[model samples]
Target: MDTEFELFDDDKSDVNAPPSYHAVSMSSISADSVQCEPSFVFSKAQTKQIRTTVLSLIRGMVITPDFILSSVGPTLDACATSLPAAEFTDILQESNIEGHTPLYWAIVNKRPEVLSAFHKFITAYKNDSFHDVRLACMVTNDHTLFTKLSLTSARLHKMERTLNLSLGCADEIQVYEGDTENQFTAKMQITMFQTRIRVVQKLRMEFIAQGRIWGLLFHVGDDTRWEASIYLSKHSLPARPKALLTVEAQNEQHQVLKKEFKLKEGCFLAASEYTNFSIRTCTSTSASLGSWPIFNDTIYMDSNGTLHAKLDVALQ
Candidate 1:
């Protein structure tokens, strides 16, 4: 039988207290209190203790009411406050041996407060720029969790809402939400292909692969053209300096069309420079196409306006 997870005692309803780390001076902080004082000191032992404590809580807690949900955010925040910035980030980003991280569980469980708390912690920790966990897509270990995830992960992956376009809008930008698979691939499905046949001068969708940020850009004109480019020093760099990019889209009447481009550091576009960007930047491949999309949809998009396409890269 499943039991409700308790975060604190009845007397401290508003306080989020995880197990003690046996520090020099430990105090129970209110769940509603702001982050701890900067002058507060944390020992390495305390950091390690809280890390184990939080992971245990994440595994044991089951969703039931908003009270439990509400308590978790502050509990995580308090645990975070006990660690130094780098250790805090490493825990937030590290996965267990099972190939899942605390954030992954929070996301799969559909805990907005947990995600929201993480967003705050990350932003505060890395104030210079925003940081997000680099996940290709959500994955779960068991059938029950997988079934639960299927219902909640849609907003982050598939396209479901209505999209409208005006005919021949110049350099008009529309971002097709991408779905990910193939370990390091992102699929861009353009819904409303009928509209693309008319408008769709340019379209783009972005996803992360192999810890690097990437985007698929499409230009439909006298001919259709697509480019797969990786973001530069902007985020994390690709493990390899070069890669072979494969693009698959649909030709007229849903025929599969495939193309490949060799990308290296020399292929970088110098125009993408931005201040404070980290290292050597983006590489790209663009080619004119006779048609649109190549996902299973060149095999899945209906006779309606949807066209599906995919691009994958080989780490060479």
Candidate 2:
């Protein structure tokens, strides 16, 4: 935000005033007699080039405020998942040039993606071992964001907090029931301590049709795992709770890069249960738990698009 202007001394009058010019005939002033100091000035083209160079340099810096504000998704994703726990805490605690924490900056700019990524990122930090809870709590702009951050406080970092600190999506997966695509989602929660850590993730199945259900499990566990499962109700068939489902991994464009598989994967629920099928095992080798990318939004298709699911599989 620096301005390219010169400050005048006391000897000069009205430094802020616009320049005044007196109308004079061209012949009145002789070019040879009038002498003036030559100032270094760039031409229009040169000025534009200079501006472009400066902007490019600014963009190259890792912690520039402009870059952070514009691309919070990628920025926060990198910080949250890749950085060491201490370094991540340092960034959250540090303030930008405008005297605002990164979290506050994201809040002021309404970067929900950044906030969400941060929430996912801090899930890896050891519970009760937090050292920067104060910095996160100081943000008062967004009450919702503040509430989420408050849940990270050391004093409140307990089993209840563990349940509250879940990292998953609401209604992330959906299945069409008789032409209506009903929703399903899995929530992954992490609990950490000074000496021991425990993690629990669950996928809830609420709606079903013809005793068939399809869903994706993102980051089922470490190594960037993803799973696609199909389940059938025990009552749908005469005896066995098992069913057959074909699963395949599709790219963003829905192009199948991985082949399909037919497997015996299905669970049964009685009338007491809300949905009939709630199987957790993936039916394909491609979708099984392995080393997948963190930002992988790859879609896992069942029966070639009859049912689909995807999730942000970020590493803490």
- Poorly placed runs, candidate 1 (over 4 Å): 1-113, 116-183, 193-200, 220-233, 238-254, 264-282, 290-301
Clashing pairs in 2: none
Give the alpha carbon lDDT tens digit for every residue of 198-298 in model 2: 13232322222332222222225444354433332221221122222233344555553332324334522222223324443332222453333222242
Candidate 1's residue-wise lDDT over 84-164, tens digit each? 676666666555313445455465466656655655655332211112222312122222222222211112322321133
TM for candidate 1 is 0.40
Residue 81 error for model 1, in Å? 18
Which candidate's lDDT is highest?
1
Give the C-alpha miss distance for residue 265 in model 1, angstroms: 8.9
| C-alpha TM-score for every candidate | 0.40, 0.23
Please give the lDDT score at residue 303 for candidate 1: 61
Backbone clashes per model, in order? 9, 0
Worst lDDT 10-window in candidate 1: 168-177
Best by TM-score: 1
Cα error, candidate 1, residue 85 (Å)? 24
